[model samples]
Target chain A: MRHALILLGVLMAGMGLSVEAGLLGPLGEQVGHLSATLSIFMVGALLLSLALVFAPKRQLGALFKQPRWLLTGGILGPVYVIVLTLATPLVGVGMTMVGILCGQVAASVAIDHFGWLGSEQRKVDGYRIGALAMILAALWLM
Target chain B: MLLPLIFILLLVGGAVLAAQSSINGRLGAKAGVIESSWLTFVIGAVLTFLLMFFFEPAQQATLFSVPKWQLTGALFGVVYMLAIVFAVPRVGTAAATVAVISGQLLMSLLIDHFGWLSNAVRPLDASRYIAMALLIGAIGLIYLSHQQRHRRLASQPS
Candidate 1:
């Protein structure tokens, strides 16, 4: 029972993310997508900043010595925004979403298979393959 | 074709998302999770500002006129980013992703059914129900696989 609740909590967080992301499309229609992207990140930055103020400071200097790859996450943020902004109009929201899902599953599987980006190396077995197939089917149903 | 290219971009976007979580997890290992998340948003804000300057004119009129709730997308983003930062390291990327995707599908169903956030009202039909069930199954399989793998590794001699 306890484990089930934890799983439910994770699912709820995921759902929250999706619902918020879903709203971005309509919001973007009112404001240009680029402008909306800017606004979204701006809000995120503001909120994050507020949270950081109360948090204890860390030795951030070590980050400069880490592999350049570890620090490059910021670059991907704009790419995601651009893709959502551009793809939604061309393929419609549903198709764009499905495409993103497909990409995510495929990428996750590959990343795990290779242990890329410090992820644990997980083998590509039949069960995971089947799981991917189901995800694609879910996309089709959507 | 333009269609294929858009699909490609979406795919790349998803991959980038996975990378973003992994990178943030690494940074979180060094700096605290909240600090890492803040830095990411800070860099993201700067990049977005530059993009806005190039691609979009400052639409001050529409900006202020938008419903207050619409601006909450970023807050949602903060929640999601924080979730990823916390989950990826503990759960491993694949399992964490499956859990997140399942959550997304469930919420998406609710959103479509009620047409929340101005989405079109999509009734929860048989197909939708089946897909949700399949996702639950997928999540189960992914979790089981992770457990088995861990068990097998643990049983082996160090």
Candidate 2:
């Protein structure tokens, strides 16, 4: 039951990304991709911080107390955005999206299979391999 | 040289993106989801500001000048951040990523077909239709495997 909801939520997240892709394109055309990306983060951070003010106070200090490696996740946010900014012009959007899916499939499967990054261990069984193959074929077809 | 470099970079970008969310999911388990997402945006805002200052060229128009609808796109990033942080640990990273990717594929196709956001009109082709079907099949297979695996785990004595 809970799993179904999470699946739905993530799907919505994906939809949001698609909207972002469409919207960002125009902004990138107006301003360079880097500037557009900065604009995005600036607005998001401002809005989220504003929202946070009224919400329950977080144990934000606890975040700093955690291992340093964990901090890298936040840093990766800009890395991914900057990468997209740089790569989009070299390769078209379609190819870039395919490359992203390929990398995501490989990493997600491997990370979970090995229980990397403290994720739960799930074996890479035949079904997953089949799914991966199908995803690859889909990308190829695309 | 440039083609291969960009290809490798895009691949790295994808890995970084998926891995970041998974790691953040763990962080979300420790910190609250909103706080975890907030951390990314805060860090991201500062980092991108520096990059933009040094690297980005002057813009024709600022954010405020763009069509208001375009600005709304930024809000969706927040939704994605919160959702991924909430979903990754619960659904497992693979399932969450696949689900999100599937959604992207579908929505992107629609956006292309309709030329939404003033993008050039690019109608979907036969290959795209087939790709969509294959993605759905892949999702179905992954979901079943995930469910079966969890059921077995749940039945076992902890």
Candidate 3:
């Protein structure tokens, strides 16, 4: 049940992400993707800081001492938002997501296979290749 | 050419996102999920502000005039980021991403169907349904393969 709840939370979060994607395209039309994404990130920062105030305090400064790689956790988010915002108007949300899935699966598989990005080396064999083929076919069909 | 480039950018963005989850998960192992997520927002805010200043023109006037609901994109983003940060350590990055992809596809279908948020309405059709089913099949294959790999590794002596 605990695991199930976690998966459910992930799923709900995914749904929320999709909604954000949906909103971003139109918002980007009114304001440029960069401007819109900047605003969103600012809002996210505000919301997170508010939550932190209520939670137990930690040595937040310690995170700054960590390696640059780990500390830059938030960097990719704007990249994703800007790209999604740009693609949505052209391709629509479905195809945009299809394209994203393709990139995600390819990158994830590569990361596992090569142990890139500090991951354990998971082999790339026929089974994994076949799964990727299916996902590619699915994207093509979409 | 522009369209394809946009798509490619989106793809790279997705790949970056996968990497971010793994990175953030590791970060979370130290600082806890909420704090790690907060840290992410901090860095992201700075990066975005710079981007907004240089590349994107100022649009504060248009921004405030828009519907209040449109400003809520950040709320969804926070939830999404927090979920990935928490799920990555528990389920591992690939499985967590697959779950996210599934949810995204489902919601994307709904949004396209309803034309929500002033989006273009693309009604559901047989091809789209088949496409979604294929995605599900892909997810099953990935999940099953992941499980088998886990079992195989577990049985091996450390």
Candidate closest to the true structure, highest lDDT: 2
Q: Better model by lDDT, 1 or 3?
A: 1
lDDT of all predictions, in order shown? Answer: 0.79, 0.82, 0.77
Quote model 2's TM-score. 0.93
Query: Is 1 or 2 the stronger prediction by DockQ?
Result: 2
- Clashes (candidate 1): 0
Every model's TM-score? 0.91, 0.93, 0.85
Residue A138, model 2: lDDT of 74
| lDDT of candidate 2 over A15-61, digit per residue (tens) | 88989978887778897787778777888888878777777776778
Per-residue lDDT of model 3, residues B99-148, tens digit only: 67767776787788889877789887887787678666755665666667
Q: What's the DockQ of model 2?
A: 0.73
Docking class of 1: medium
Per-residue lDDT value at B135 in model 3 = 61
**Which candidate gets the maximum TM-score versus the true structure?**
2
Off by over 4 Å in 1: A1-9, B57-60
Every model's DockQ: 0.65, 0.73, 0.58
Per prediction, fnat is 0.69, 0.76, 0.67
